[model samples]
Target: MSNIEIVDSNISTNSEKSCVFDSSINIDEISYNDFFSNYLIANKPCIIQSNATKNWPCKKDWIQNGAPNFTLLKQLFGDCTVPVADCNKRFYNSQDKDEMTINDYLNYWMDFRAQNYPTDSPLLYLKDWHCKKEHPKMSIYQVPKYFASDWLNEYYSGRTNLNDDYMFVYIGPKGSWTPFHADVFSSYSWSANIHGRKRWLIFPPGEENHLRDSFGKLNYDVLEDERIKNDNKSVKFYDIIQETGEIIFVPSGWHHQVWNLEDTISINHNWVNGCNINNMWLALKNELLSVMREIEDCKEMEDWSSHCQLMLKASHGMNYAQFYDFLSFIAEKRINSLVYKTPNLSFDTWIFGKNHNLFDLRQIKIILENFVEDAKDKSIYNLICKNDEVEMLLNKIELVFQSCK
Candidate 1:
C-alpha cells in the first residue's frame, strides 16, 4: 500500500468529518469481482462513485485544499518537456467554457521548460505526447518513492500492478479536455482527480463506428475537426466533477474524450488484465486479415489478368472489394493444411516462369488431386470445384493431359 500527499489551494477542509463537500464516492467499497466481471472486463465505461483513493490516508487531505497552487504545479512540472506544433501554438479553447484542454497547456509548458530548464533537474522530457497509443508524462520528482507507498499499492491491488503499467499525471488550468480516441493497444485505466471536475464522453467497442476513415489508424488532430463533432450522433458523454479523492475506471477499446472543468490536477494509470489481452489479440487478427487480403489481390492480377481488368472496369477501377471477396471464397474452400502451410514456390517466381517447368500439368494435377481429396474428406471439395475459375483451371489441365496421352 502506497500513499501520496497532494497539496491543493482551491479545496479547504471544513471539519474533522468533512472536507470541501461530501460529493466524493468511495471506490474500495465495490467488490472487485463484480466490477471486473460485469463492467471493466466487458469494456464498458462507468463511474465507480468514490472508488479511487479510498485506501489512501492522504485522499481526504489532498481534497480538502484542492490541488496545489500554480507555483507548486510549476515546481513539480516546470522542467518536463513536451511536444509543440509547427506554428508553436500550445493552447486551445474547449467547446465548454468551464474546462481547459490539458494537452495544449502541457505542450506549452514542456516547450518552455525544455528551452530554459536545467538538464540536471529531476524533470525529464515527455516522449510520445502526440501519439495516441503512448502514455502521458510523469514527473520524476513525484513518482516512484511517492507512488509506491502502502495506500496506493493496496488501492490498485484489485486492478493491476502499477509498476508494469504506463502512468501519467495531468496538470492544467481550468478548461482542459482530451480529444476523443481509443487507445492504440488495449489498455485498462484508472484516473484519480486531485483538484477540479472532469467530464468524459465514452462509447463501447463495436457499439459505434467512432472512426471516420480507416478503422485502425487514428489522427489525433481529428478531435478539432468540426465534421467529427457534427457526425458523431451515437456517442454518450458523462460529466464527473471530482473535487478530490476520486478516481475513474476506463475500459479497453472504449472511445473517450476528457475535459477538465476548472483548474485541475489528475493522475492516470493504464494497465491490461487477462480479458484485455484477448481483446488485443482480436484487434491484431483483424490487422493480419487486412494484410492477407492485399496479398491475395496481387495474386489475382497474375492468375486472372483478363478477369481482373474486367472487374476493375466494371467497378470504375475500384475492384479491390470484389477481389477480396473472391479470395475469401477461395480460402473458405482450401484445406487447413494447405492454407496453413508455406507455399513451395513464391508467387512472383511461379508467375514469372522461374518455377514454370516445376508447375507443369502433371505436377499440378498431382497436387490438385491430393488437395481435392483432403477437401472432400472435410466436405469442402464441391465448394472449391464449383468455383468457375477453379473449373477453368481443371479443364485446362485435362486438355494438357489429353494432348500428352
Candidate 2:
C-alpha cells in the first residue's frame, strides 16, 4: 500500500509564491506547418487565443450565470453513468475514482455545495465523459487545425471496441482537480475551457524526476509539494490560469496538474500526429517493457510472451499487433489514395495538398518508414513481423513510397 493523503481542496495559499513561466504565446490564428515546427516538434506549450469554440452549444446550454447548469445536466444526462474523481481524496498518487449517474452526482453536488463541500466524502469531478458520441446532435466544438491530424481518435472511431476517444468533457465544482501526471502515451494534449477558470501547474518534461517519489509516482498536489520547492529546488514550473474559451496546448510528455479555480467545464483532447508519432511509439515500447518486467517470473510458463502481449493490450489500450493494425490501416488507405490519385478521398491529399503540402502522402510514407525502422529496433518487432498482414503491409508501404518517388 502507498501513502494516502487526504487534502483540503480549497487551499489557495500557494498563490502567494512567485512562479515564473513564459506567458503562453498568444496567437489569433496559426498554420499547420508553423505549429508543427515551433510547438509540436519543438515540444513547447502555448495558448491560442481565439473565439474558436464560441459556437459550441454547450457554451450557452450547459452554463448559466457563470457556472455549470446543474439542473440542465441532470435533465439532459440524468441516467448517464459517468466516471467521477474524488478530488480531495488521494489513492496513492492519483485521485480516487468512482461512477455515478449524472442525476445522482448532481444531487450529491447540490447537497455538498449547500453544505459548502465538506472535506470528507470527496469532491465529485466528472472527468473524461464521452459527450460527442452520446449527444452527436449537439454541435459542440471543432478540433483546431494545428492539432488536427489525430490518429488516435480517427482510428478508434471506426472501431466499436472503444467508442470513446481523446475528446472529453470535464465538469467539476470549484477546487476539484486532477493530480500531476503526463498525458498517456506521451501524446500531446489540448484543453479548451468551455466555462469557468482553471489553475494549471505545468512542468516541462525531464523535471518530473524531481517530483516523483522512489516508487516512480508523482506527488498528488503539485502546487503544494514542499519536497519539490524546498529540497530539489531546481525544478521550474508554469502556473497558468486558463480562462473560459481559451485553448491551452500541452506539448508531448509535459507533466501537469489542473485545479478548477471555479466551477468549471472543459473540453480536452489527447492527440498524436506525424510530429509526435515517434514519441508515441517510444511510449508504447516503454509500456511493453514495463509489462514484461511485471510478469518476468512467469517467462518460462507456456505462452508467456502471449500473456505479456495480452497484458500490454489490457494495460495500455493497445499492443504491438494493434499498433501494426493501425499503421497498416492508415498506410493502406494512403497507398490506395495515391494509386488511384483520388484527392477527395485522401485525407493526406486534402490536408497536405497533392504534393509537397503540409502533410502529403510522401511525407506520411517517410514517417511510416521511420516508424517501421524504429519498430524493428524493438525485440517484439520480430513477433509483429511474423504476422503475414504486417509483412504485406510493410511491402505495400514500401511500394507506394517508391512509386511516388
Candidate 3:
C-alpha cells in the first residue's frame, strides 16, 4: 500500500466523534508511477498536498483576505450565464438548479452575506459551471498527470451531440453543501480547494451498508443521522477537513458528502481511466437495472430493451451505443499512438510507451469483447460490430496488441 496512516481525532463525549475512520493517507510530491501503482491501481483514496495548484492563478486572483474575490471574479466572468443550484432544496435526487448570469449570483451572494437579508430565500450554489469549455481564455490550471487521461472530456470536445465536459467549478456559501452521493458513473474524482475550507465525510465502498436503511434508502445527512453516530461498528468513514489548495482523490464508488466550512470555491473533475473503467461499466449496469425495475411492468412490450436504452441514456447520460463509441474512440487513440508513432498517447500516457500503450489497448479490447458478448441482444452490439469503422478499429487494436507480444 502507499503509506497508510490512521487519522483519528480527539474524542469528546459526543458519540459522533467517538470513533474515527480506519486510516487517512496524505502524500506530497507523489510521482506519476507511485500515484498510479499505489492509489489508482489499488483503488484507494488519498489526499495529495498543495503542490499541484500552488502556481494556479486562481490561488491568488480568486482569493483576497481569506475569502473569494467577488470584485475580481465579477471583472473576469460577470456576464457569463452559469448554472446555480438551490442547496436548501432537493429535487429529482439532486439540488434544484437553474441558469442565471454570474453577476446575478454575485448579487445574491453579496446580499445573503450582508446583514439580515431574507433568510427564507434558498441558499443558491453555483454548481457545475464548465470552467474550461465556457471560458477557454482562462488557463487556471492544467489537469494533473494522474488525471489527464480523462476519456470523458477527450471524447466530447466540440462535438455537437456530446458537448458536455466533466471539469466543473463549485462555489457556495458557508452553509451550502452537496448531499450524500457517489460520483456520476461511479467515476474517480479529484477536488481542489482554491478559496476556502470544506468538510468531507467519505465512506469507502461496502461501508455504505451502515448508512442504507432496511429498505435500501440512504441517509440524506451523515452528521444529523443518529444511526450513523450510533453505529460504532460495521462502518468507519473518513472525516476530512480539506483546506485551501489541497487535492482529495476520491476513488471510484466511494460515497461522500461535503460541507463548506467557509465560503468556498473549488475545481473538480470526474474521470474514467483504465484503472476504474470496470467500475464505471458496473455502475451503468446498476443504473440500467434500476431503470428496468422501475418500468418492469412494461417488459412484455416488444421494444422493452429499446425503452431501457432510451431511459438509460436520459438517466445515466450514455446508452450502449454511446458507451461503445467512447470505448472505440479511446481504443483507436491508443492504437494510433502505438502504431503511428505520435507523441500523444492519451493524457498521462506519455511517459510509459509501448508497454503501457499495449496494456491499455489490451484492456480496452477485453472490455469491448466483454461488452459485446454480454449485450448480444442489444442493438448497439449489432450496430457496432457490423459497422466497418468500429470493426476496423478493433482489428487495428488487436493487431497492435498481438505484435507487441
lDDT of 1 by residue, 201-229 (tens): 55555533545547554434444545446
Winner on lDDT between 2 and 3 is 3
Shift of residue 8 alpha carbon in model 1, Å: 42
Stronger candidate by lDDT (1 vs 3): 3
Tens-digit lDDT track of model 2 for 25-86: 54455555556556765777777764766776788788888767888888888999889988
lDDT, residue 4, candidate 1: 20
User: If scored against the real structure, what TM-score would every candidate get?
Assistant: 0.44, 0.84, 0.87
Score candidate 2 by lDDT: 0.71
**lDDT at position 98, candidate 2:** 92
> What does the lDDT come to for candidate 3?
0.75
Compose the digit string of candidate 3's lDDT tens values, residues 27-53.
Answer: 445566556666766777777777668
Candidate 2 segments whose C-alpha is farther than 4 A from its true place? 1-27, 227-233, 341-352, 355-382
TM-score of 3: 0.87
Q: Least lDDT summed over 10 consecutive residues: which range in candidate 3?
A: 4-13
* lDDT value, candidate 1, whole model: 0.41
In angstroms, the error of model 2 at 213 is 2.1
